[model samples]
Target: MDSDRESNSSSSSTSSSSSTSSSSSSLSSSSSSYKMIKAKVFIWVDSELKDIYKIDEKLTWVEQKENIVTKLLPPLYKIVNKKYSITNRKLLKMLYGRWRSRHRTSNIKNQGDERVKQNKRRSSKNSRMQEKKKRRAHATNYLIENKNKYILRYPEEDLVKILKDSGYHSEEWEETDPEEEWPITQSAVVEDDEIIEEAIKQKSSSIYIHNKWWRSPALLRLLHDRIDPTVELLKKKPLTLKRKRAQSSQSRYNTSNVPPIGVPSWCLNQDALEQFNYSNVNIPVYDYNTDDQDNSDNDIEDENNNEEEIQNRTNSS
Candidate 1:
């Protein structure tokens, strides 16, 4: 009974140890799985957290230097699914700080531009477009400059137009002479060139009596500056009115009496040039000019023929 009891106890001990080892092994595996679940990082395009972001472990130096991604959101998920710490400064600089500094430098230049714009705005109140708004608000059709009193009460526009057209040159029909009218001379055509030169001066002074002056007469100067250079290039031109001059008939007579220029002495008549045959005539060819003593080979050597040439020539033994 003692030996059988001893064997029974040994087998019971072995079974208990086996059971404990199995329990420990299971607990170790569970703990490891729990740590894995805690350490896992998820990055995706949506907030539902169902998907895992595609992480590129084999990123090249060029791609890391380029730093194409610059966000920290979930929906966009501009970064990869790898976990980062602030301690990894080199990695952060390589991925983002490289390209971001370039944009920061460009923003610095824009800051300078913004400062210049502010200075200009402060210097001139009109630069902020305040005058433009006032001009727009007080705009009018300028029918005789705010007339308060008129003698006629009711004159039909058609009848007034007819009366004005008939008596355009007569000053008695209107209260003021027509300032817009000008004779069609060359000076009159270019009269709008300097129309608003003294407007700034007149604005400060009280006495500004220019009846022909209207709003924005600088536009007339601008039109003249742009039109004068390219007036000849106009494709559709009006009928040219030629003025009859006093000496025009005399000029015509003088031009008719004058001979046509650039006519050669030998080619005076076209019929003679066509009829004459050079083959039957002995035309002597002069190799040198007889008038030019220097070029003539007529018994003159070393340019010693003329007295002037003899005096100008260098002395030789």
Candidate 2:
């Protein structure tokens, strides 16, 4: 009985130790479950706070900050320490403000970038247009310079072509060609004759005002007016008056009293007077003498032919 009592007491002591260890294990398990539940509850509370504290939806930067502060910070605060949680909120707000400011600056810079690109594109397009205009202007100048070589050489045709090539409308040149074709409607011939007269006046040989090869109408007219008085005086009193004065004495002498200047008395014979007399009348006498000789020869031939006929008639009778 004593040994059984000892064994029962020892069994009772082991049962008590086992029961205490089991109770301790149960307490530890319940504490772990409570901590897990608290962690879950804290996470849920953080999510709710994030939704409640969100800033304007348009301000996504601020919204992100609120999410980081509320949803993401609490867990980190628990791991780091509870004392830093208050300080983390202030730091988070400051960082979010700085981030927002930087974000706004970046947005402004992006707008400036777009404006610069647009201006560059516009400037490039304007420069290209200016270059095209310059090229077209050069082409027009070249055409105008070469207009004289046209097939028609008509100013109206040339004017129309020039206006057409220069980008002007046809209506702008509607009257240009016709106007050139009938340049002076009322008196073209008169104008042309006037031009010819002016040209002739300017082309005088002895009229050298400036010794130039050509002169304008204005210059030629000035020169003519300046020199006209002297030319008129020269025409009124010509150099032929001196020759007439010298010949007056020669006509006063008779033909027989005027001997030849260079004649020698020994060489002067009657043959010269006869030769002179014959030579002086030779042309008139030869002209009349040819007709006289021709009439005498015709009369002799007629008498001879009449005598032959008379003799023949006598012989036949």
Candidate 3:
């Protein structure tokens, strides 16, 4: 009976020890799982936090990133996994640098394109301005060259059209007047005279003498005589009609009677005066000629004096 009791006690002790050990092992495993669930692991992709994973403390930063990338963009994950053979820190830095470089390149390209467009616009504007200047110069030269052929009053557009219609190209002909289809009439001459007179009245220096009118000496003489005297009078005495009218009206108001409208005493003629005969007139002539010998002697003396002075200066030098 004693042996039996001893053996039973030994067996019970072994069973209790085994149970305690099993319970302790279960508690340790449960604690490790709880710690892993509680611990936080942050994962980033392209500088942005993608996900927070509850992972074991044993996981490295590289593993975490790889997991994140795998979950987000699979293709990028492959590229990162294949390219990144260095440490996690170096890999992050390289990725950031690459992104920055790509963005910078794109920005530079965009700026360059914009600059090119601006340059093109500036060049086009300059070309257009140059073309306008050339056209203006050509038109001015054309007007100057054909000044004597056409009246100044003639429209530039009309002149161009007329020249084109006459089969005369502006580039082909130079400093020459084209022949006209019709002859100039007396009426046209009168019109030109009227235009010239009006231009003179307006204090204009330029005259529009048509090709046909240019041939008439009588008309030119008449215009010269009229224009010269009128211009001189205008310069010497500028008449203010308004002021004169005012003064005249005041004087008339001051007087008792109105002024007569008849001709003045200086202009009144009774037709009884004898007219002078310029055809058969005899006039006394006087001869007071200059001495050529004296003038020649004086010129010779001046020349000699100039030569002597020049010689003296040369000798001194």
Candidate 4:
């Protein structure tokens, strides 16, 4: 009975210890699984972050430096490979050394794959650029061969349509005159006196008025009256108008010849006829003498003009 009782106790102790060990194992496994899931979630989040941008499909040097140190060495190898023209046993050894050091690095297992992916992407880009250059060269050669026939000068809309019919992709060209593009109204073309005054008032630049007195006849006469005394004092010399002495016979025969308008007259501006001075003030005595000579010359010119007209008419007939 004693032996059986001891055996039962031992068996019970063994069963309890076994049950405790199983429970502890289960708890440890569960904790490991939780830790693995958390680590995976952190990695996924870090990978997707925009600030964690990649270079050459893998993380950039900045990103890898922050998260994965082991990937940094092979990229250095690539840089050295690009920079130095000498590709020899030394460079090969250095690359091998980096590649082998990868296995010894404990923390970053993904570094090797990142470097490989970067190299592959870089290779693809180089190949694509080479292909593009080849295509461009071929296209340029084709264009050069047919430049005279294929090239269009100042191409119009119809040329674009023709190109499109011949399977070319063409964009629309815009042609517009710069002057006609301004938004000028018809009223602005025929501006009124008020508008003209406003424009002159707003004008910032100086205008040279050639004979501004000609625009206002009243002002011109007022100026002439003001400056008359100054003119009389200028007696250094006087330029006389050339005149022909009237033949005594012709003078008597031509009583019907009225004086032409604006003849010289000192008698016209008399104060007794002040109102008539403005209307009938003859040209200045000196100016009238000059003008009379010009008129007689003009009459001679008119006779010559009539002769030319008669000759032209006869030629035409």
Candidate 5:
């Protein structure tokens, strides 16, 4: 009986210990399930770190504060705003407010938002690059049209002749057959890229403003305030002015000041002055230049195209 009692007590103690361990494990697992691992973002901005709470243009004030709390580090998020001067504060507001994604893109955001932001930035960059390329191409065409106007570093046709002559014997260097296209090499690709970059920087050097400023470099001062952010700068045109009908200079000059026959001078001077300033007049003034007007019948049916594309997805699917 004494031996049985001792054996029973030992079994009971072991079972109790196991039960306690299982309960402790269950509590730990429940606590762990409630906890979540959050993702973090890291950025390396201009070598010197800035000290301020960040403001976002796209996001509201509440969202900005939330982003500051969740995205920024503890030290950065905790920084308080100081009592700035009235003028300085207003200027700062304008500076921060001038957030145009079309020209310049911001990088501050969460991981997912950053991806979308980067895509927009890339598109903007590509558009700007295309515009620059187009401008350079136009400049090059102008130079070609008036060869004597712009002085070339290499005026001789030696390079062109050599390239033309070499084209006949391209098969010698190419790995493929003469009938097939030659494979693109790394050097050829790099050279093409370098040529494009060099062409854009060759012209449109600040002609007027750069020389006008005597002592102070006024370029930085000019950039101090945003230049009408809501409205975009008009597309720059060529330097040449286009002349209309009445080829003679005297007739061209007098077209504006002289009132038409049948219209009185007093009437022309009164209401027409302000109205004609914006390409409008009380009486019809024939514009000889604009002959071809827009015909809306030529517009593409984008919705129909989209519907057709969706319906025709069977082959791919």
Candidate 6:
């Protein structure tokens, strides 16, 4: 009875230990699953290492970056953790902003509004004509405004460099308000038009100007005036003055005194000229003698008879 009690106690202890081990393993797995559900990290992972990992929410920025680096580059993980570091807020904001920008989309309603605007632009003729008129007006105004001040139209970057090279500081220019320096007004436009005309008149005397200034308003106005005159001149033939040849007093021959060559007597006689100028020059004459006429008639009859015989032979064959 004592031996059986000892054996039963041993078996009971072993069974309890096995059950406890299984329950502990189950609890650990459940705790890990709960942590994964709570943490909202959506990082891309390698297929081979796609296992869920436990992350601490209270980790420092540097610790988070290190963690990310470790996960992404495992081979260099140890080196980075030991040497590299980054602030938590900056890294988080940077990554979040980048991802959001890349993945963000516009609403369908906004896209529909844009499509409607495009369709209206395509279908309206009045709108297109108005746009063209506006463009021409703007171009004309631009031409008038920069007539004498074309040199001042350099790009901001180039202007800045030029100012620097000339020992002029930007601070001085910035301190002086443009309104105070040159007040703009309605009369400025009128003044610009007058200036453009004056500049065009001045440029008319010069043959050429700098290529950069070729498209200036003054030049355009000059070209317009020049083109009209040229077109009108082209419509009419140019007048050519007939220069008289001066006679030489010492010369032996004189064109005025020279006489024309005379025509031959044969040329003057029309009937004789026509007769000799033909391909059949030999004229046929009828003989008055009866013997000669009879011989001629006989020859003609013989030719007629031969031609008839040849025709009959060809038809029969």
Q: Which candidate ranks first by TM-score, i.e. highest?
A: 5
Each candidate: what lDDT? 0.30, 0.37, 0.34, 0.34, 0.31, 0.33
What's the ranking of the predictions by lDDT, best on top?
A: 2, 4, 3, 6, 5, 1
Which residue pairs come into collision in candidate 5? none
Task: Please give, for residues 37-87, the per-residue lDDT of candidate 6 as tens digits.
Answer: 223223322232346332333444356555555554353233323533424
- Could you give candidate 3's per-residue lDDT for residues 1-317 as a string of tens digits? 64454445445544543455577569879867544422211123433433432322234445555653445444334445563333445444444444455555555556888775555544543453353334433443333333311122223333233322311111110111213422233323246446532211111111111121111222222223212222232232343211111223322222222112221121112221112112222321111012235555654454355456546765798
Query: Per-residue lDDT of 30-143 in model 5, one digit per residue for the tens?
Result: 655322110011121111123334445565545465544444434432221122222333333333334334123333444467687656554643453354334433332222
Q: For candidate 5, report its TM-score.
A: 0.18
Which of 3 and 6 is the better model by lDDT? 3
- Pairs of colliding residues, candidate 3: none
RMSD of 1: 47.6
The backbone clash count of each candidate, in order, is: 0, 0, 0, 0, 0, 1
Query: Candidate 2 lDDT, tens digit per residue, 161-212?
Result: 3223312110000011213333332332346446522211121111001122
Model 1 lDDT on a 0 to 1 scale: 0.30
In lDDT terms, how accurate is model 4? Answer: 0.34
- After TM-score superposition, what is the CA distance of residue 76 in candidate 2 from its true location, in Å? 4.0
> What's the lDDT of the predicted structure labeled candidate 5?
0.31
How many Å off is the CA of 58 in candidate 4? 12
TM-score of 6: 0.14
**Top of the candidates by lDDT:** 2
Model 6 alpha-carbon drift over 4 Å, by segment:
1-83, 106-317
Better of 3 and 4 by TM-score: 4
Candidate 1 per-residue lDDT over residues 148-247, each given as its tens digit: 0110111223112322231111111011222343233333223457553322211111111111111122222212222221222221344232222223
Displacement of the residue 10 alpha carbon in candidate 3, Å: 99
